[model samples]
Target: MTSTLVVIGHGMVGHRLADRLRELDTAHRWRVCVLGEEPEPAYDRVRLSAYLRNRSRAALSLVRPDFLADPRITVRSASPAVSVDRRARTVHTAGGEPITYDALVLATGSRPFVPPVPGRHLGNCFVQRTVEDIDALSAAARPGRPAVVIGGGLLGLEAAQGLQLLGMRPHLVESAPHLMPAQLDGEAARVLQDGAARLGLHLHCGTTVVSVDGGAGGLVRSVTLGDGSVVEADLVVFAAGIRPRDDLPVTPALPLAERGGYLTDAFCRTADDRIWAVGECAAVLGRCHGLVAPGYRMADSVACGLTGHHADPLDEMDDSTELKLLGVHVATFGSTSGDAGTAVEVTFQEGASRYAKVFLHRASGALLGGILAGETGSRADLAPWVGRRPTADLESVLFPAPPFRPLSP
Candidate 1:
């Protein structure tokens, strides 16, 4: 009895699952069908901002050229699964096609969150998410105009920098006291703020957007801040945040996260054993990992389960991330706490562009975690030692090694 699997998304995580299944299902035990609402196949959304500069759709593609050639796999673009008839084990698409599957995987990914402010639907307001979004923004981007990017997160910063690259003045707004509130400590955020300023992005932190008002022709002309201050702008881009795309039909009405996303077990399995969720849509242990690395790990776990391997349930995934935002390098990993004085903390802040800090067990000197804001010179090496036993040679890990005047060895 050949089992058919209907994957209801084709984003990075969905595609990864399909690739793994194709690789492992040597006996062809399962035939696969992937549904993507987008007109094009899965592409690298991580680099979506680069679309403005590159303008080549082919370059952002994550789909293999031969993906469609596989005899056991089929892909349907521009088709979204509208509803799931669980009793019948079928998925109904917007195109009026019913796809039957012995098992279903929901990887609908996420959607950009647009805050409900007056005139949000104004002409020049956009959300930075899909390739089409960047394309549309790029079309409206003109030299010497100003673009207001709402949010100071990674995506928001990316949009700001992309607009700056296109010769447009970019202003960044954030409700948080600093950028990347979830990832960076106060000092680290200060460092990142300095970097953004260097890249020509005007900062508006710790304020809210009151409203966006339109001028003649109903295009975005100015924006009102929380403090009643207004700024002239040609366009507004919302990179606020993302919410899981969990509205799609799921048979049995799978449990959803309080914040919005499909709730699942560590194995990525929903309430029904035959159904699974992964990627941004899967909320494991009451939290959704918006990053791609954890999504990949979940994809691998689901693949192992479907391939008949008793893979251990995903637990304690390393959420450490390192990336360059607007040409600023920022990285953080493990526990960030050292204020309790339980651990020894060493910090080095060089001017406004560089800050590095590492925490170690006070007694044994074991590496705990660290923060690298501006210029991180090979500090990534310390990530692997996060859980390792303490080493006596903490001098090497310090920003500046202690003076070595010993016998010229």
Candidate 2:
């Protein structure tokens, strides 16, 4: 007896879920149907900025070349899931096609949050989310022209770098006091600011975009800041943030998070057992994980549940991350900052480029959270030790033994 499964959105996390179910369901107990909004199949979204340099579609693809040919799976590109009728166990597509399913998974992912500025919808303004968005931006940007990227976070900085590669002078604007507020603390962000400057991006932190000014041709010409400063821009790219794509199938009965997203339990199951959500569209424990790491974990858990295994409730997730942004290395493990009574901080800096900070419980000597900027040579060794107890000596815990440890009691 084969059960039909309908997966909405074919992004990386959605594809991972589909692949996992197929691999584990050896008895052919499940048949899968995937509906993707984008014309292209799943690709490496983390490497999206890199597409500006290479301009090759195949380079960013996440699908195995021959995997989609499986008879048990059916994929439809450019077909988005418009609605899900839980009562009838059917999904409606944008093309007016109805897909029946025994189980449904929502992987609608998210869309870039473009601020409602006056001229945002004008020409030469783009949001960095899909391949088409980047392509349109590339075509609109000209060499040596001034470009404004409205965000100093990871994606915004990446977009600025991509604009630079296209021979455009880039300016980065951030509403927060510093860049990467979610990942790096104030000090770490200062060092990262210096690194971004070295990469040829002019930065403006602690400012808000009041409005975008357009030229007579209905194209963006400049942006006005809160302090009455106007920056001339030939092209503007918005990488401010993301909002979950939750408005579909008009299901008001489904549980939703505070902001937006399908509220799911530990196993990524919604109030309706037959309906499950994963990826950016899933809000678990009242928190929506925007990053891919947690999404992958959720997909793994869902697969385990569907395959007749008792999926253990997730106790914790390794949200620790280490990645290079705009020629700077940034890593955050466990916690980025500590404010508890037992919090104790230790910091280590080398030369002018590398910085590391660690927080631990003063009484138990257990690791709390940390931030690392510049050269992160020890991140590989440090991140794994998070949440564990260290020796009586705190200095050794802050800095690990030379790359490969000597290992002593």
Candidate 3:
């Protein structure tokens, strides 16, 4: 008898789980049903800013052509799971439909963390998450108008750049002393700041927004910083961070991690053997990973377990990231920082444009972690050497010789 597998949420990671299961279940032992809250199918959220340029939904879609045609897969868009009955093995949808399943997977991703501040509920304030949010922002953005983007991390920078592309003057605000504090150190952040400045992007670091003043018609007029200074703006975007979506009404109430997310074991399974959690909604082994790489790994692990394939538990997760922000290359891998007693730190700087730092084990030469800015050509080469010693010399790995150049005659 074939079993029914119900997957809640159809974001990237959720979609990936369904795809993996379809590939692994060659014997057709299970039927899959995916429930999504959004009306549109899963798209590449990491490149969401690209929508500001072309405004094409199909360009960002992750769905395969044959995916919807597969007889074994059923997809229900705009249908959010309202509650789960563990004892009955049933999932209740918002549309008053109950789905019975042999196995259930919760892939309900996350939501943007908007800070609790005065005047935050005013019009013109937005959070970048779904396609609908982007459409609203695009419709409100006007040329030469002042806009303020909260948070200087990856998402904030992307939001600021998107506003700039819409011909708005964007001012980035970050509570941290430097930009991307979670990934890049001060020096590397400085280099990235310089690059951003060259692109006409204004930045305000080391301060928090205390209040957002409203104008007529309940629209945003200006935002007050922690230092009693104010930045005039018509638009405000909060990209501070994300909180996992683990508030679904479960019959017995699923336990959450300290930081928030469905608590799961290394196998991505909850206390009940019939249910599992993946993606940002899952907190595996008391820790929640906010990146897509780890979420993909979690999805794979669960798919393998359900398909009766031997799979490794999700214990070691790779948090490495490499991307370009405002034309500046930035990459971080493994452990980027360590106290003086635990590890040795090596740094290299070339003027104000390039900075690189690597942490190595004190006793052995094994690579621990590293940060790269301005030039990240070496990221692909160094990613494989993360937890092990490099085959080549350290200098060669860090500062690879530039391509052979011929002298001008």
* Per-residue alpha-carbon lDDT of candidate 1 for residues 55-165, written as tens digits (9 for 90 to 100): 999999988867789988899999988999888889999989899889899999999999999989999899988888888888898889888999988889888888997
**Ranking of predictions according to lDDT:** 3, 2, 1
- Total backbone collisions for each predicted model: 1, 2, 0
- How far is 134's C-alpha from truth in model 1 (Å)? 0.9
Which one is best on lDDT? 3
lDDT of 1 at 174: 93
Candidate number that wins on lDDT, 1 or 3? 3
TM-score of each predicted structure versus truth: 0.93, 0.94, 0.96
| lDDT string, candidate 3, 22-82, tens digits | 9999999999999999998788888889988999999999999899899999999999999
Q: Candidates 1 and 2: which is better by TM-score?
A: 2
Clashing pairs in 3: none
Candidate-wise lDDT, in order: 0.83, 0.84, 0.90
- C-alpha RMSD between model 2 and the true structure: 3.4
Candidate 2: stretches off by over 4 Å? 391-409
Error of 2 at 154 (Å): 1.1
Candidate 2: residue 266 lDDT (0-100):
77
